[model samples]
Target chain A: MIRDITIGQYLPGNSVLHRLDARMKAVLTFFFIIVIFLCKNFWSLGLMIAFTLLFTAISKVPLRMMLKSLKPIFVILIFTAVLNIFYTDGGRELFGFWKLSVTDKGLYTAGFMVIRIICLITGSSLLTYTTTPTLLTDAIERLLSPLKVFKIQVNTLAMMMTLALRFIPTLIEETDRIMNAQKARGADLESGGFIKRAKALIPILIPLFVSAFRRAYELAFAMECRCYRGGEGRTRMKQMKLKARDLGAAFLVAALFCGVFFLNYRFKALI
Target chain B: MNENIIEFNNVSFAYDSEIVNAPAVVKNVTLSIKRGSFVAVLGHNGSGKSTLAKLCNAILVPQTGKVTVNGMDTADNGLTFDIRRTVGMVFQNPDNQIVATVVEDDVAFGPENLGVEPKEIRRRVDEALKSVGMYDYRLFEPHKLSGGQKQRVAIAGITAMQTECIVLDEPTAMLDPRGRLEVMETVKRLNRELGITVVFITHFMNEATQADRVLVMDDGGIILDGTPKEVFSHKEIIIDAGLDLPAAAEFSDMLISDGFNLPDGILTAEECIEAIYAEAKKRGVC
Candidate 1:
């Protein structure tokens, strides 16, 4: 049951998307999100959808996995689409009953919104699906290095993130062990009601927290023994370098932005 | 250069030194570890062995006396980094010591902290992992490895720093028998091939028999310090310190007491077997 979590799910591969520099991939993902929001009319939305599909195909992440990423947001999608169909105004009315009405414009807007959201999700998921979490954090640290000018400890924050990511699986396994130990000791964690279950978790959480603190103390000592003195003179082993592929990706994203702007200007607003 | 990689000059430490009379965990200990020697410290729980390991790298400065690593005083804050660089430490808990998800990244952590160039770090990381027999596991996540494998990775992390001496505080205590053997073999190889000094702190008597020297600690003081055979020969001191002699030594001692001819200071099963066979042949019994 604990293994169902798909957060930070990265599929390893040697595909083009996987080989792209993580920093550039992150920047491109941000630009893709903005372009998706700027999309207007069927032409712009279609372009965005095509861009997402191409990215997914190049990423080599299975199509089933891409659709699985959307499963968790199914409720939100249905809720938003239903609201858009029932409440949106403009264009010719399609049907009406007792002050509730649906119009062609409403249908158009619902379809556009759903497609826009799907494109946005897929574009960002492609980035994570290709880049490992370690590389992603490295990219973030480099991207945010400028913040160091404000006297902020960007390196320290990034180190904390890296440590946290490294320990997630370890801590999850610890939690599983603790839970089973508790169960063996006659702790009824599963059959309880909502409040009872939460209360029952107190036993597990207290021990978990204690062990986590112990781990942190030991890790700090280990790090110090390795001559870790903050990030002053630290050099990274995996250095991020932008290659020709990054430039090509940047150009393609620029073209995507321009296409969306042209489509928005050429077509009338749907909602 | 001094022959000693680490020297403890009457060092004593207390976690809470502010109290009027806090008991020192390490009590007036004066010792020197020779360069490139494998020394195993044997002590039961609360025997200050862990505190001594911490002092090797300046993780815990001596409150009363002085501790030096490679001629640098551990108490001096300016020399702490250099001291730690010369003497790396591997703690008991492997899970807590590993700081990276991927094995190679974790191995590179020590060199990265020392500001080694990216190219050098990569080369050293590969070399260290290969030396520990973990080169193939470099790209593997640490969590997926066995307990013994994780401990080896932790050792590789220290090796990448190219430290002259390594102080491990019960690194194999949490491991199973197989895991303990794996760690011991890896440590032995590092010491034998790379000439890395090892100050292994453990309670397992058999593990200590493999070391060139052994120090038995009790009540925060060294009870015996000599070659493994000499130390194990003092059976009373070992038993009084809440410890046990290695199985081979104990069996040999029992045989000697039962009117059988057996050699003294037998520390390995093979040695005991050979002695017993010699005795039997002398008597024409087999």
Candidate 2:
């Protein structure tokens, strides 16, 4: 059960999308999301879907992974479909059964909504799947650097995010170790009542809490010994750079956004 | 070499709640360790050897006594940082002790803590990694490295700090056999080749054989203190304290009692083989 939990999943690749500046990718993703929502009719939506598929292809992320991500949201899709099918009111009524009615408008609304949602998820997942977590946090910090005006301590925040991302795997491993150790001691974690289940968790929690505090203490001591007083005058080995391709990709995204938004508006007018 | 680089004067430490059903961990322990030497502290589990190592660097101060490193009192708040800088510690778990994801970064961490200039930090990191034979792993993520490699990186972290002495608390306890050998070799090289003072804490008697001196503790008391040969000679006392001898040592002991002309105090396979061959030659059997 513990092995199945994938934290901050990052798949390494040498694809063009992976090579782009993280900050640009993050910003482009925002603009891309807006484009998806603005696209309404089939022509504009078709254009956006083509664009998403193109990026997805370039990223080299498998289609199966995208599908797996949507697995959890299948319930949401079904719920929305059901709600729209019987409750939606409009367009020529197709059938009537006991107080429930199915309309042509309901069928169309449900179909478009599900498709839109699936595209939205599949499109944004590209950013996370292709980019490393460290790079993603680095991009976030660089993009939010303007908040330094409010004394945000951007480097500290980014460092925290990077460390947090780095430690997620470590903590998961530790949690597994603690759970196994407790189990070896005959502490039942499964097949127990509500109160018993809670009681069983204490053995795992105590050691984990102790270990966490111990790690923090060691880290603090280590930092102090290194004279690390918090990111002042610190230079990075890998300086974040913005390449020509990064800007080119952002511009391409912007152009797509403008084209889709206007085309959708025109398509809505025709309908 | 100075006979006393570290002097603990009339030291006694009870746990904070010692008066209330709490046992004292180190009781009235007073000793001095020589400078420019490799010393191994031997004890069974819960023998207070770890607590003593902690005191050497001011990680824990004595409740009733004083520890002085090169004449500087460790308990003095003004000198605590200096004392720590003087004596670095490598812990049991190499996985947790490493501060950076990358090997070089982890090695550089200790130097960085010293507020060294960036250029010096780079130089020290490279030198330390090279000394530990991990220069090639500089770019590797620490978690991907094997147990021995991670421990070596942790040692490099302490080495880069340029501490005069290193105190390792069971550095090989979690390691496999090969990992244990690699770490022990590295520890010896740092001590003998680099002339750095080494205080190794371990339950492995074979590891203790590599050191210049051995200090054995039993039940919060100093049971035996001498060179390896002198200490291991009191074999009965150590075993009585519930610590087993290294395999080679045990084999040598059995052979000795069986009147096989084998020499005493064999600690490693190489040593045992050398002694057995010499005996064969003496008996004209080989």
Candidate 3:
């Protein structure tokens, strides 16, 4: 059951999007998100959708897997759609109720929001689906290096992030082992109230925490044994260099941003 | 210059030296590891074997005496980095040692920390991985690897640092039999082919038999230290140290008591087999 998580999952591929620089992909994803929000009408939203789908297709990640990334956010999507349908007002009223009314504007707004959200999720997940988490964190470190002027420990933060990403699967496995051990000892974690179930997790949590601390202690020694003395004077094996493909990707995203802005201005605004 | 890669001069350490009269974990242990020799340390739990391994690389500085790695004193604060770089260490738990998600990146971590150029780090990473027979799994996630494979990768991490000596603190303890064999073979190759000095701490008698020299620790002191054959020959001392002999040695010792003229110090199965075959021929028995 714990294995179902797809966050930070990378599908190995050699597509153009996959080969794009991680820093460029990250920047473009940020810009694409802003463009999605800047979208003022269905025409612009539709263009954003097309842009997202085109990149997804270029990434060569399976469509089903991309959709699977949305499964965890399904509840939020539905909640937003419902709230917009009932709360938003304007245009001709289509249905009426005691306190809430559905109008054409409300329906249009709900459709726009749902589509906008779908595009936002798919666009960002595309970056993760193509690039390994290591590259993404490396990109983050380099991108945030400028913030060092503010006395920020950007390198330490990035190292922490990398370590967190590296240990997620390991800790999950540890949790699974602890849970199974508790189960074997006749601990009732399955059949109980919410509070009771949470109480039952105490047995699992204690061991997990203990083992995690032990792991941390050993890991510190191991890192030191490897001559790690913080990020100062440290060089990376994989250097992030911007290639022609990165520029090409940037140009493509820029084109999408312009098209969205043009459509937002050229047509009548709809909300 | 001394031929020893590591020298311990009456080194003693305690986890709680702040307390009045805290018992030392390592008690005045004076030892030297030769530049290219393979030394295995055998002891039960809480016997200071791990402490000795830590002292080699300055992970734990000696409280009473001194430890020198490649002729540099570990007790000196400024030389700690250089000491660690000279004597790389692989801990018992493989999962805890890996710093990178991917195998190649984890192996590159040491060289990266030492500020080697990117191209050299890549070259060393590839060479280290290939030497450990893990080049095929360079792109693989470390969590997906078997215990032995992860341990080998940990060794490769140390190998990439190009350290002259590697101290493994019970590397095969968490592995299955096959995993143990794989790690042992990889370690053997690294020692024999690459000429890396190894200080392996393990309780497995069979593994100790393969080492060029073996040290038996008891209550934070070296009780026995000699060549594997010379060390295992003292059966009473070994049994009294709360350790067992290798299976071949035990069987051969029993056969000798039964009047089969087997030679002493049969530490491996092949040696026992050859001895028994020669005995049968001399006795005119098939």
Candidate 4:
């Protein structure tokens, strides 16, 4: 069960979207999210949804998997949908209850909120699905590198992130091994009360922490032995360049932004 | 002007000097490894063989005398990076030593740290991976590789740094027999083909037999030092160091004890077989 937590979630492919620069994907994803928020009417929201679907289609990740990725956020989606449905009373009532009414505006707002949330998740998931975690973090590091002028340790922060991501699978495997070892010793982790389960975790947690610390120390020694001196005068093996497709991707996002603005203006005039 | 790639001069170190008052993990040990020579250090668990390797790379600064790599003093803070770059290190645990998720990136780590140009790093990474025969696995995530493959990648990491020497602290201690053989083969190939100085610290008796010289440590000091033949000849000293003779050597000793005239320190299967054949011919038994 611990293995199901896919932190990187990258699916390797040879498509154009997968070939775009990670910074391009990351920037466009951020831009797309802000565009989602700017949608003020159904037409603009429809255009935003169209853009997201186009991205999802280009990514070629199975629709079912994309929806499955949203499972963790299902509760938030439902909660917001229900709140918007019951609250907001600015139009004709569709239903009535004790001091409660479902108006047309509330229904529209609820639909828009649900669509916006879904689009937001799918768009971001597309970015992660196409770009490996290392590349994604590298893009972030490069984007935030300007903070170095202010004496921020941006490189160290990025290194820590990359290391954290690199070790997640290893730690998960360790946790699974420790849990099984404890289980073999007849530790009752299942079929227990809440506090009992929490208490039962101590054996696993202690060993896990001990092993993690041991690994951290060994890793630090290894890093130091390789002449790691706090990000000074370091070069990278995989260099990221803004290729033609990346520029095209940026242009596509710009066009999407303009299309959303035009649709919002037209819809406001009609309303 | 010393021809020695690594020199240790009366060095000693302890983990916790203030509280425990225990003996140093590494004691007054003076040794020098010639350039392009394959040297193996053998000892039991607490014999400080690993500490000696760390001292060579300046990971553990000596408490008394100094360690010099390529004529730079390891104790000098300014030359720490230079020492590390001159003498690379591969630790026992392959998993902990790997710094990158991707195999190629991990291999590129050392060269990258050295501030090599990006183009040069790419070329060196490719060359190192190919040298270790892990070029095909350059794109694979490290967690997906086997123990042998990971160690090879770790070696590739050091190789990409273009270092003149590599110090492996029981690199095969945690590996399976097959993985051990794979790593040893890679180590030998690097030493032979690239003329890279190798300091292999291991407890495996058979592993020491392959080296040009073997140093046996007992209680943080060198107890035996010679060619494998010369060192394995002193069976009592090796045993006293809490190590066994190579299996072939033990077998040859068995034959000798049974009144056979086999020579001492027969280290390989073929040599043991030839010795038995020679004894049988001398007895006129075929």
Maximum-DockQ candidate: 3
Tell me model 2's lDDT, rounded to 2 decimals. Answer: 0.81
Tens digit of per-residue lDDT, candidate 4, span A1-271: 5544556788889889999999889989999999999988889888898888898899899998898889999999899988998887578888899988998888888888989999999999999899989989899999999999999999999999989988988899999999999999999999789999999999999999999999999999999989899888999878988998999999999999999999998877212
Candidate 1 collision pairs: none
Off by over 4 Å in 4: A1-6, A269-271, B19-21, B278-286
Worst 10 residues of 1 chain B by lDDT: B50-59
DockQ of each: 0.75, 0.18, 0.77, 0.72
Candidate 1 chain A: 10-residue stretch with minimal lDDT: A1-10
Clashing residue pairs in candidate 2 are A225-B113, A226-B112, A226-B113, A227-B113
Report the poorest 10 consecutive residues by lDDT, candidate 2 chain B: B94-103
Off by over 4 Å in 3: A1-7, A82-103
Docking class of 1: medium
Instruction: Report the lDDT of model 2 for residue A151.
Output: 86
DockQ value of candidate 3: 0.77
Per-structure clash totals for the candidates: 0, 4, 0, 0
Residue pairs in collision within model 4: none
For residues B33-109, could you state the per-residue lDDT of candidate 2 as single tens digits? 88779999999998999889888887788887899998889889888768878788888887666655557766776
- lDDT scores of the candidates, listed in order: 0.92, 0.81, 0.92, 0.91
Residue B163 lDDT, candidate 1, scale 0-100: 95
lDDT of 2 by residue, A139-158 (tens): 78778879989988997887
